[model samples]
Every structure is written in C-alpha cells, then in structure tokens.
Target chain A: MNADFLLKIDALSVSFGGVKALENYKLSLPPSRILGIIGPNGAGKTTLFNVLTGFIRPDSGHIHFNGQEITRWEPYQIARLGISRSFQNICLFGKLSVLDNVIVSCQIHERTSFLSALSKTRAYKKNEKALREKAWKLLCVFGLEKHADRRAMTLAYGDQRRLEIARALATAPKLLIIDEPAAGMNPNETQDLLDLILKLKEKFNLTIVLIEHNMNLVMQLCEYIQVLNYGRLAAEGLPLEIQQNQEVIDAYLGDTNNAGSN
Target chain B: MNKNKHALYLMISMGLFFCAVYLLDAYGNHYYQRVSNLMMIYVILTVSLNLSNGIVGISSLGQIGFMSIGAYVSAILTLPPGLKEHWLTGLPHWMSTIQSGLFPAMILAGILAAAIAFLVGIVILRLQGVFAAVTTLGFLIIVKVVAENWMTVTRGGRGISSLPTYTNLWWTSAVAVITVYVVLRIIRSPYGRSMLAVREHDLAAQSIGINAPRIRLLAFVISAFFTAVAGALWANLIGVVSPGSFYLWLTLLIIIMMVVGGMGSVTGSVFSAIGFTILLELLRGFENKIAVYGISSIIFAIVFMLVIIFHPDGVMGDREFSWDWFKRITPLF
Candidate 1:
C-alpha cells in the first residue's frame, strides 16, 4: 500500500499464451501529474491499462492504488476503488441519452439499487436529482450540456469523444486512463480536446494516463512519457529528452510505413 | 393526450377491458371462454420473453425449456385421481397438496421454474449467440426426453390427461396482467438499465462499474420464472400434456411472436402475442395448409429475418412507450 503514490505498478508482466504482451513493467506517480505512454500499434499500451484496471489480470504483478494491493481486482473493483478508464474505442452506452450515460457512470455514488428505483423511495429521488445535476454540470464543462437529451450514439464524432471524457469524469476518479482522446479528431477539434483535458484535470485534481499517437499532444501535454517499441519500454523521460533519445527516434519514428503506429 | 397520459389511459382501459372480458366469459359459451384462457397464457409467455430479448437483448429461443419445467411440475402436482391412476403414478406427497386448487399450483409451478432458470442461468448464461441457443435447446430436448421415458409419472408418449380445467379466464387473465406489469417494472429499474447497458456494451457497463454478468443472469432467470408459470396455465387450459407439448417448434413460435411484435417492446410483445394466438386459434379449424401462415411459427421467422436485416434496433429500439411523454405532447381531442 502506497497511498502517497496515486498510482503504482510493480513488476508487471502479462502473457497471452506464448506471446508477451507486457513484461516486467513498473511505474509510480502521485496526483496532479500527466503520464503519456507512446508506442507502436502492438506496443502493449492497452494491455497495461487492462492489467491496472483488472480487465485482464497479469500472470505476475502487483497493482497498488492509494495504498491498496489490487493485483487481481476486477474492472468494477478498480473502479470502485476510484480508478476509472475509457476504452481505446469510445465505449459509451450507445442506446442511452448522453445525460443518462453520464448518470449511469455515476452509479458509484448512487445510493439506490434497482429495487428502490421501482418504488421511487426518498433516497432514490434525492440522490437521482443530485446525480443528474452533477452529470449536467459535467456535460456543461465539455460544452455538451445542450446535447444531453440526444442519444449518445447520435453524437457527431467530436462530441462523442468529448462525451466519453465527460462520462469518465463523472466517476470522480482519483486516477483516469484515457486510451486515445485525440484519435479521429480534426486538428482544431484536437486542440479543443487538449484545452478541455487541461481544464478538467485541474478542476478534478486527477492524475491522468494517456495512450496517444499524436506527438504534438503528447509532447505539449504530458509531464513525463513512457515509450514502447514492442511491449517493452523503449525509453522513459521528459518529452524533450524522448524527442531527442536516439533509440526512441530510430524505433518509433523510424518506420514511415507504420506512421502513427501508436 | 400525451404519451404518458395515453399510456396511463391505455393501461387503465386495458384493465377495465380485460376485467369485462373475464366477466363476460363467466356468462359466455364454454368455447369462447376457453379461447380467451389460451390468449391470456400467450400474453404471459410473450411479455416475459420481451424482458430478455427486448430490454436486455439476449435474443433467446430456449424459453420453452422453462415452460416445460412449469408444465410438468404443475401437471404432476395437480393430477386428479383418475388421471393420476391412468398415468401409473404414485404421486409425490407435495403433489397431493396442490391438487387442492388452481392458484397454489400455478404459483408453485412458477417458483419451481424460476428456481431451475436461476440455477441454469448461473451455468449457461456466460455463453452468448449460438452457444447459448444450443445449450438451452439441448436443455429443452432433455426435458422432453425425460417426460417421455418417465412414463410412471408423465405417462410417456401417451402424455398426462384429464387435467382439471380450473385455469379459466378469471385467474389466467389475472396472471396475464400481473406478469406484464412485473416485466415492465423490471425493465425500468436500475437492474433493468444495467442489463440494457450490458446489451448495448458489456465493457462499457463494467467500465462504468456496473456488474455486467450478474445483471444478465438476473434478467435471464426472472424471464424464465414467469414464462414457466404461463406454461402451467397452458397445460391446464389445453387439458392435455404430452412429450410433444414443448417442442422446438413451440420455442421458435414464441420467439417469432416476440420478434414480430418487436423485441424489447412491452406493447409490441403483448399485441403480437394476442394477435398471433387468436389468429392461430381460428386457423386450427381450417386444416393443415393454412395453419403455418396463421401460426407465429412462420410469421416470426419472416419478421425475425427482417428485424435483423432492417430494424436491428427492434420495434421499440430502447424507447419505452412513455405515458408521461404522451401527457406532455398530446393534443386534446
């Protein structure tokens, strides 16, 4: 248990049968920091997130968050422990309204269960009002308050991406992992996304881990960076040092054919 | 009126209408009354299946297994003395008690069926698509086979007969109304929303801290339980039970009614089930050829194909028919 460290992965290794997905990986960070992970398409970035969040338990590793050993925790368990994640593909509930989607994500704070919702108990009504207000404010922060009543699946690509962030933030997570917030965005939208990320990170006091291929966003936004070539760390340091690191340059930026590999 | 007010009025109207039908049956010819009893049972079957396929999106065709469990449990328990002797059975002591009347037997049958479904859900629910369909289909076959070979209790291929025709319109219609309300209530709860979330996206639901597997299991079991009680009512209404009672054809037909009506739509399921059942009940007098067209067995297949092809969001597409919306939006006539 290392409560002082907002997140820590100790000696993590994941293997899918014989193929190694991630190996002997380790990192530790406190709150109010952004860690960017960049690697090729198969560099095990998503696998790392899965391991930390218990979507896939590593064959060997210990994941500690806010002072609890959480190696084999389920995805829901990690979430309840205040760690939240967004998938590489914006995994919002497509059939629900955007506002409803955010409210569902905030179930961590909802006191009522399915039984109580049927009866419309006082706790259910009171808590639901507060949760809806919270979800509305989150959508407002992301400039999505106007679209709250629309189906989440009907959102245009940019709003969908922004709504994913809003939904993730609704969890009130201590640590948030976003697979790729800037993917599929136009340059202008990407900049808007970056600005929104900075605002929300400060507003929520969150430690963020981002997996992104956009060099500009990574270089400008992350305080620390971890680079991977093929499931193993290629380099780890400041953004300037990473841009100049000979190994990172030759490995990640080397292949023009696999451009945007991460 | 608005959608909510419309729905509220419709619900109130439906209650009054069904009650009037029950009262009319009390004074009507025996044959018309019997047909109404059959329609009420179909209402339960279709409405309960809607909870799974419509709201939760499991897309099942194995509900006959649950119904079969209900049928055999209720029939065995409620077998009158002559029928019991003819079936070559020394009744289980518990069966002796339910032979007393209709409500107890149906209630017990529903509970028994739900318990089986709850247990089976724990085992086979992790499977989706064809694997789940196969598992449940196999379950149905096993139940039928047991009914055949266990002649001492089930009367084998000859089936159980002389079942007391106690499940008249009064009680059957009551079950119909209650089951539809129960399933409707289920889909509107947090549990219902979580099941819908899982259907929409399993990883997303879990990512949001909803327990996906558990929610699926709950919906699956509850649907099974209610469907089973409907089966018990059917067994009594028809006054005959056989190995042929719960064939795959029936399962396919149930699925068809659900699909044509619109999977995941309460109003759709109920309307389709009643229309399909009444149409078939009429067609049974027309001999063999037209029966296929009249029965949902054929209609469901076509509707299912089209639903999957064009209307994959289903008839309702996650939208509850909101009486509240009706109240807000409707123009006063």
Candidate 2:
C-alpha cells in the first residue's frame, strides 16, 4: 500500500464468457506523471480501461483511486471523481456544436439543478456564463475557438481528436485516461500531439494514462511504460528500459507481422 | 442581454398566439372548433413523445399505454357518483361513492401516469435501441389488455360512456400552451442538453459524467406527465373512454405526426400536429359521402409515404422558430 500513489490496482482479472480479456493486471501510478500502456491488438489494454472506468466489471480485482475504493462505481461516478477518458473511436456528440460538447463535459463538476436551469435564475445564468467562458478557454487552447459553433461531426479528423481531449479536460479530471489519441494521425500530427500532451500535463499538473499505438509519440511523451501481450504484462519500466526489453520486442514483432500480413 | 430579449419575444408571441386561437374558437363553427381541440391534444402528445423518442433517442411506442392510464384514471375519478354506481357495478363501494372534480382528477391522472412510466422506464430503459422499443410495445399491449378485460373499474371491453364533457377549445389549448412552455424550458436547460447527448451516443454521454439511463428516465417520466394530460383531455372531448380508442392506431398517428414534423424539432411537432389534424378531418368528410370507408386511413398512409420519401427530416430539421427571425422587423425603438 503506497500512501502517495494516486491509483493502485492489484490482481485485476476479467473474462467474457470463456475467454480472458485481462488477467492479473497490476498497476501503481503516482500523481503528476504520464504513464503509457502499449500492447498489440486484443492484448486487453482497452479491457483494463473499461474496467477502470466502470464500463465493465472485473471478474476479480481491487482498484483504489485517490484513497478510495472505486472498483464498482458507475461510469458517471468515476468521471465525477475526476477520472475522465476519451474513446478509441471518436465519440463526440455529432449533432451538438463543438463548444456545446465541452460545455456538457464541464457540467460534470459544475452542475446547476434542473429547477434552477428551468427558472433561468440569475445565479444559474451566472454559473452558466462562467462555464461557457471556461469551455471557450479550453477550445482556445486547442485552437478550436473559430469552429466553436460548427457541428462537431463536421470537424476534420485531427481536430475532432483534439476536441475530444479538450472535452475530457473540461471535466477537471485528476486522472485523464485517453485511448489511442494518435491512432490515425500523420507523423507531423503525431509530433504535434506529443507536444500538446506534454503541454497539457504541465499546464494542469495532470496525471495522464494513455494507450497509444504510435511508438514515436509514446516514446516522446511517456516517462514510464507498461507493455502487454495476450492479456499478460510483458514489460514494465522506464521508456528506455522497455525499448530494450527482449519480450517487448518479440511481442511487438509478432503482432506487427500478423497485422501486416492481414 | 440577448437572452432577456429572446425571452421577451417568446412571451409576446405566445400571448398573441393564444389570443388568436381563443378568438377563432369563439367565432368558428362546431367542426372548426372540434378540429382545433384535436390538434391541441395531438400537439401535447407529439411534443411529449418527442422528448423520449427524439431527444432521448429511445424509440418507445408505449406512449399509448401511459395515455390509456391517464384516460381511465381521470374518467373514473371525475364520473358522477350516481352514474358510477350504475355504470361500474363491479367497482368497490368506496370508489363508487367518490366523485372528484375534473381539475383534480386530471392532475391525479398525470401523476399516476408519471409514476407508472417512472417504474417501467427504470426496467425497460436498460434495454438498448430497438429492443427497448419492443419491450415498451409489449407494455402498450398489456395496458390495452388490462383495459379491455378489467371489468371491475373499466367496465370491460364495452368501455364507459355518457361521461361529462369537460374539454373544450379553451381548456385544451391552454394545456397545449403550458405543455409547449414547459418543454421549451426543459430543452433550454442543462438537463435537456444531457438528454440530447444521451440520444447522440449513450456511451459517450456516460463517459462525460452524464447518467444515460437517469437522463432517459427523466425525459420518459416528464413525457408521460404531458402525455397523460393529453389523454385526459381526449377522454373528455370524445365523451367516452375505451381500450379501442388507444390502440396501435393511435400510436401510429402520434408517430406520424412526429416524423412528418421533423422528429427532433419542437416547432416541427407543433405545426405537423396542426397539419395532420386538418388533413385527417378533410379525409373523414370523404368517408361520410363516398362509398369508400377508411378513407382517412388511406390519406394518412399516402401522406406518411410521401413524407418519408420526399421530406424525411420533416418541415424542420432540428431548427426552431427563433426571435432572431423577428429582429430584422423591429422598429428600432
């Protein structure tokens, strides 16, 4: 039991029917750190995220976050507890404007009652105005202010990805977990994303846990790395140490060959 | 500043609109007044349905179930105690002796319907997409069966007749305005935004700390409230209450009004409710003179098919009639 650690998980296991999605996963993360989780496809990276975010219950596990047990909380509860995530596939509210997406996210912690909103009271309007300004500030950081009124679905793919991160940040999360933020970007875009991730970490003093397939971005952005293969941990160390680990290399090579062949 | 101005404009327009409708009711013929009443009731129904079907993204056909609950409950409560004894012999003695006024009965009807909808929504809202719709459809069937077979309170399949006519153009339209006002308030509120997010993608909504099922339930319960009120109005208007009046046909009529009015647009729902009511009345006239029966159904079918083909998004695609449309005409005061 590390008193200073912000998130601690032990013996986490989950199975869907007969197949094991995650087995005996363990993690200890400190505050104000960037930890990267890398794995081949079907290696249970997303499954772990699902369990942590309360989308899926683990068959057996214990998860403690910010000195409280949160293993069985609902997704919305997890989010309100300052744990926010973005999806692997973009999940922006397609019909709402980009600004509205962030505004909705901002409501997680800063909520006005339904009655007050219905009344449109002075207090409610003031709170709403402050939140709207905060949302605009987030958009401005991501260079999305110009397109704040445009429908989220109409944004370019890279911008949509950026908007997702901005929306997540609007939750005022202590632990921000982003899944595959650089999945479809070009090299230049990936480089830009790496810079943005670092900048956000400094700006917000955030603890980030990201799963990425882009090796360059992962190597540049992560201080610590954990590798998984076939639902088992292959390596865990600093980024340089994981790069030199034989098991990690073999796992990546094997999966790359399979993916390339297909 | 703009928000206050928008609110003022809305208030003025709504006041004028109601005044015009009241005058028309006073001057119009019996046929015209009847059509207008039906239109207002449908407006209430479609707007409430829009909250669940369009805003919350739940395809529920169980609205007719809630409507039936409202109709029977209100009708039973408001019936004269003397008539209750003769019409519903199977009812308990205490129930037969209680005769409530129309206003309180309608309020209770709305509350009862909302309670049932809340309980049912908690269970069936967990089902995703079409499965949820199917479960709610089953709910509608069960309500119909209960209304038909439960002779104790409902008088079985024959239904209750000779009820007092408490509904008129003024009352119906007043309720309609209230419904619209409440719905607009909800749509502009934070809760409404959360409901819309749930409609877009439930998973994303949950991730953003919006409880998808809870939001859906809120919309469902509120929708049931207004839907029940509409049913109470309808029961009084026709001077009868029957299981047959609130069957799949009524559900289909409400859905058509929603689809043809642009599923997600409140303004579209209001206008489409008016448009279809007039169209159906015209077709009913044909059924009386011509040898053909079910002419109204045929016309409705044609209109639905045409709307689906040509204007699938309805007359308004998630757009509202806003005060901005009036800003240009201001006298620069």
Question: Among these predicted structures, which one has the highest TM-score?
Answer: 2
| DockQ result, candidate 2 | 0.79
Give the C-alpha interface root-mean-square deviation per candidate.
Answer: 1.5, 0.8
- Minimal lDDT window, size 10, model 2 chain B: B324-333
Rounded to one decimal, what is candidate 1's iRMSD? 1.5
TM-score of each: 0.91, 0.95
User: Tens-digit lDDT track for model 1 on A16-117?
Assistant: 999999988889888889999999898999999988888898989788888888899778777878888888888888878898888878766554666676
| Native contacts present in each candidate (fraction) | 0.60, 0.74
In candidate 1, stretches whose alpha carbon ends up further than 4 angstroms from where it belongs are: A111-114, A254-262, B1-11, B81-98, B285-317, B322-333
lDDT tens readout by residue for model 2, A182-205: 999999989899989889999988
Candidate with maximal DockQ: 2
